[model samples]
Target: MEKTDFDTLIERSKNIRTAYHQLELQHHGSKWTIEEDTLAFLTDAGLVGRNTMSQQGRWPKTETDAELKHKLGECVWWLTVIADRMNIDIKDAVEHFLTKTENLLEK
Candidate 1:
């Protein structure tokens, strides 16, 4: 069977993160702990919110649409990595969330 898109994303994200960990080990003496990674994800999530506000004209238009789009993608990549680090399967988690939400909304 062919791999799903989500499966491909998980694999690629893990590979990229592994490469970054190697660089961090060489330069910083250690890879970041999961807590540090979660903090980084939160930081990016904040940027996504700020850029979204800029796009919506709620804030000063300091960022371009391309920059906002890049941040949005980065947030997804961060979520995948964070989930993997926590021993959660991101694809399954998303599926469960969607299914549960849909069922709730159907009532």
Candidate 2:
């Protein structure tokens, strides 16, 4: 397949979300609240409970390297949808964020 642009990915993500929503509606379900969806998205991405280290005093028993990798991909998909919905150029947004962070770290 050919490579796709950020805008294309965003459009595709919207389509996927629409289909997911339709399935929920068909099953007499409700849309996920923003918070719920966000949590769900993060959990699915393996970024929630799979922390490599425990902040409270111990290391995590379960390894999450694979889960974290998968979740990062999912996060990119979610981000594309959000950026598209907001009419933002995700590519530019990412660049701007990186640039800002780099400049801040240089201080």
Candidate 3:
């Protein structure tokens, strides 16, 4: 697979959100309410159930590593939507956070 840049990832995330909303409109006769879409995306991404870390004590588990990775991607999609809805630039937000953490650690 090819590596994607930040811009590409953001665009792809937005596209997925748009497609999901379109489907919702078709089936439910309305675009997704903000909360509904966020939760639905998270659930579809398999991040809804009990926390995986909490289940680490159990030797046997059903979900594969690949599934977890996909769920992580879904989380990115959710974050992208939230950022866009709030008119926040996620790239800048992330950079600011990283810089702040780095400065704090250096002190």
User: Which has the greatest lDDT?
Assistant: 1
Question: What are the Cα lDDT values of the candidates?
Answer: 0.90, 0.69, 0.75
lDDT of 2 by residue, 1-107 (tens): 59988677877888997887788778867865556556666666555334434333355555566665666667887777656556778889999999999999999
Per-candidate TM-scores read: 0.91, 0.61, 0.79
Clash pairs for candidate 1: none
Using TM-score as the yardstick, the better of models 1 and 3 is 1
Q: Which stretches of candidate 1 lie over 4 Å from their true place?
A: 1-4
Kindly list the per-residue Cα lDDT of model 1 for residues 15-105, writing each as its tens digit.
9999999999999999999999989989988988888898899998865588888888888898999999999989899999999999999
Off by over 4 Å in 2: 47-70, 82-92
Count: clashes, candidate 3: 0
Candidate ranking under TM-score, highest first, comes to 1, 3, 2
TM-score of 1: 0.91
Candidate 3, residue 63: Cα displacement in angstroms equals: 4.6
